[model samples]
Target: MTAHGRLPVVYFPEADERLSSWAARMAPFYAMTVSEFVAALGLKGHDVFDLEWRLSEGQGALIAARTGLSPEAVQAMTFRELGAAARMMIARKSRSACPHCPEDLHRKAAAQPWRFRCKVHGVEFRDATGETLSDRFGADCFKKLEGHAEAGAAHLDAWACGAGQGDLKAPEVLQVLTARHRRASPPNVDEQPRMSLKDRRDYQDFLTTPILRQALTVVVPEYDQAAPVLAKPVRPGLHALAQGSLLQCFALTVGIGRIIEDPVKWAISVMLVSDAEGQGRVRQAISPWPLSLKRRISARFWRAERDERARQSAEKAARQRQSHKYRLIQSHKYRYRIS
Candidate 1:
């Protein structure tokens, strides 16, 4: 059985022919034949058919290097014991679906993970509530979604489980999720539309529900939290909501009317969710509606205020000029004007 945050266990019957095939696929990577690889691993007291690791490919590679194995072998091993290792990995990778709403603003500044409580409606994941957000996200997707670690753990897990839902085939799922999120978002008065705290909460809640979350879990069974030594930090916008980087840019769809501008660049950034079928030049990159995005909105408001001020100033200046001219004419005509 799978334990939370551990690799899924595979229970391939000893008599299965796939066992030999699994070994064969892994042999070249490990510099051995199927029999040699199995014998080598078995000699090392590792259940070659049941070995498991987190979803980090680098980590898997590291483990393989240390064990004198190859990347392919490590992955194959994860798949071979797909029963127990896979379950353990998934349980450990669940993320909290709660939205920290209004107060979320403050929590983001402190940069603390657990300080914020549920501020928005429908932020709760449980209808269990005992599970911490950390526990919910487990260890895998939590890091990647946050941009702290890599984002392909789900693909790796799929491979290990023989789930046939690897990197090449996972976009459809992401597209659907992204679409749902887009449809629920409301338009703003300005050119750019930002998701409100309430909308984000509702969408997040729906995402964590069993229907979608389970599908993701099936497609991506294991995740890794460790970042590679050279891995770059995640951009603030792409960072997940849990990190308080709202308005993560997903897709850049064309403006049917005036609502959307810069469709080409926006679409490129969202390439993760779109496929060749929807491919186009990046019109613009729509990032999360953070302070930066709000600047434009604030600027528009400021410009309007400034324009009104300018108009009032002009009117006041004109009145003053008229008064001064009238006073001068009166003074010229009558020497004792004040009296």
Candidate 2:
């Protein structure tokens, strides 16, 4: 191979690997930046920017010749052939990468917005630049959360395919679920220290929106109302918050999964439907199920909602009674002479 042809053999692409990530890994073998590598292939401007789109025949030939791979192999590696709806699932930003992966290997699935942990290593995914999003947070929570992501993805795909009728858009559903997670587990000390004051305040507001709170309650019937802690300094609340966030995220995904037919099958397939012991874990993950075991949990949630309304009503009545009594007292005082 010539000096210009000194590219690494294309790393075997994972099921969901992005073409961009593959290019990034190949860049080092050629001793060039990813952009430089793509530009050298004669792709210009926007073509270089959009790696998911299939390369032109000439561009494919150029890369094939340089890498000593067939044009068919080059084409197979690109995600550009996937349907438009499928492409939306790929995150535009490289949100996470696998820490345990070889230096030259980055799993494309990790970069997807819905994925939380590395499938192979069972570790928390890192941010685009390969830094932990929260040092205090552990991978265990994310691993648990990932078990439910398949269910979430199913719902998302269904919606994208126009299978459901709902007021919420697909993006809104994801945002609401993420907000629920943020609320259930507010940023701990490790996460807060990295944020600016304004960002912290904004994050607090984002988590506490009325819609998010309602969504949280719907998904997690056992959820308790936790007051915002933005005014206070960050403290050591990592473990509890991590666990809460994981549960919340998983609950939200299960709730989304409930909309599909045969929800139990969907949930089970996403989790442990095969193993008997694992089935118990799956049940625990999707507890307070408004779908599976609907009668018991649904009744419980209804009772809780009724009790909340009654409590509010009692409080309003008590305030009204006090106001009426005060008015009567004032009337009597006005009728009588000044004491």
Candidate 3:
């Protein structure tokens, strides 16, 4: 545990663009046919999605049922069509937070409330839900549908795992070693200005402080529980360095593979290693954004920047009205002499 005995939050494995690229190469098929593939891969029974049987299986059925097509009908749909449907279905289900309270109200309100207040909680807020919630037809119905989903299960993990429930780990902060130490650059030459020898020594000592080591243990349970296959017991500092180095090597391999543009191989590596959560931590420590979000975010940012510029222009006009030039014009009384 950390010095304060808290564990770090972990995220589920992200779908990789590299893997998606490989999957995209599959021959085209109808949406129903693609649904069959999904069913087959997940070993789902045809009745698993039956409306009559839906309640027993719970909210997952809500997603499947939204298609209004039976599992068999879904199986008959084309892959290309199913691809669009699948995206809509997923985006539909992701929880929408209340525009007011932190609680997710599940896309209940459509137009900005009279004062842009959330109808449910009557407060103004913005988050993933508020941003992604559709402004179109689904906005109202989806809110009710999502409530049904929530009634079935409180969180994604619970929904996925089913009836024998338990709490999922919440996000926490823990200390970790500053494994890599680079030489301080000359004062004027680099971003990290030079530090004195004593300072460096003091920093090194801080890294080894007992509280920090405890934090590492708290954060990374795997380190305490799963002994690395190292031959000897190394100092905590050395251990951190070794683990960090391996993660760096794996990242480099990923980079090299990307440079070569080998999607299949990249997919294989990602799928194979995704289960090793500790390694995921190491990867995140080095580079936070994975490929999928990176690709999608660029598109989001383009639109966001465009909208921001529009907003700024409007605001600028208002500001100009308050300026001296505008004031002078407003204050000036022009006498129109009829010639």
- Which candidate number has the best lDDT? 2
Tell me the tens digit of each residue's lDDT in model 3 across 1-339. Answer: 122221132111112111111112221232234234324333245432231112223333332353233443323221221222122122211123344443221232211111122445554334343442223213564343333233322222222223333221101000112211112122222212255878767665433332211223222223323222221122332222223322221122222223123322322233222334543443343233345643444455456657777989999987986786766765563422322
Top candidate (TM-score) = 2
Query: How far off is residue 289 in model 2, in Å?
Result: 21
Better of 2 and 3 by lDDT: 2
Better of 1 and 2 by lDDT: 2
Clashes in each model (backbone N, CA, C under 3 Å)? 44, 0, 17
TM-score per candidate, in order?
Answer: 0.18, 0.48, 0.19
Evaluated against the true structure, the overall lDDT of model 3 is 0.29
- For model 2, what is the alpha-carbon lDDT of residue 91? 46
Report the CA-based lDDT of candidate 2 relative to the real structure.
0.49
lDDT of each: 0.33, 0.49, 0.29
Which stretches of candidate 1 lie above 4 Å from their native place? Answer: 1-50, 53-92, 96-339
Model 1, range 1-339, lDDT digits (tens) per residue? 111222222223121122334445456765666556645543334443333322257645554544544566555534334434233222111222344332112211122112112333434332124543335455454433333111233343353355865223222222322332121122223312255878767666433333211111111223112211111122221122223211111110001111122222223233333333322211112233334433554465456557767989999999999999999988887877656
lDDT of 2 at 53: 56
lDDT of 2 at 95: 46
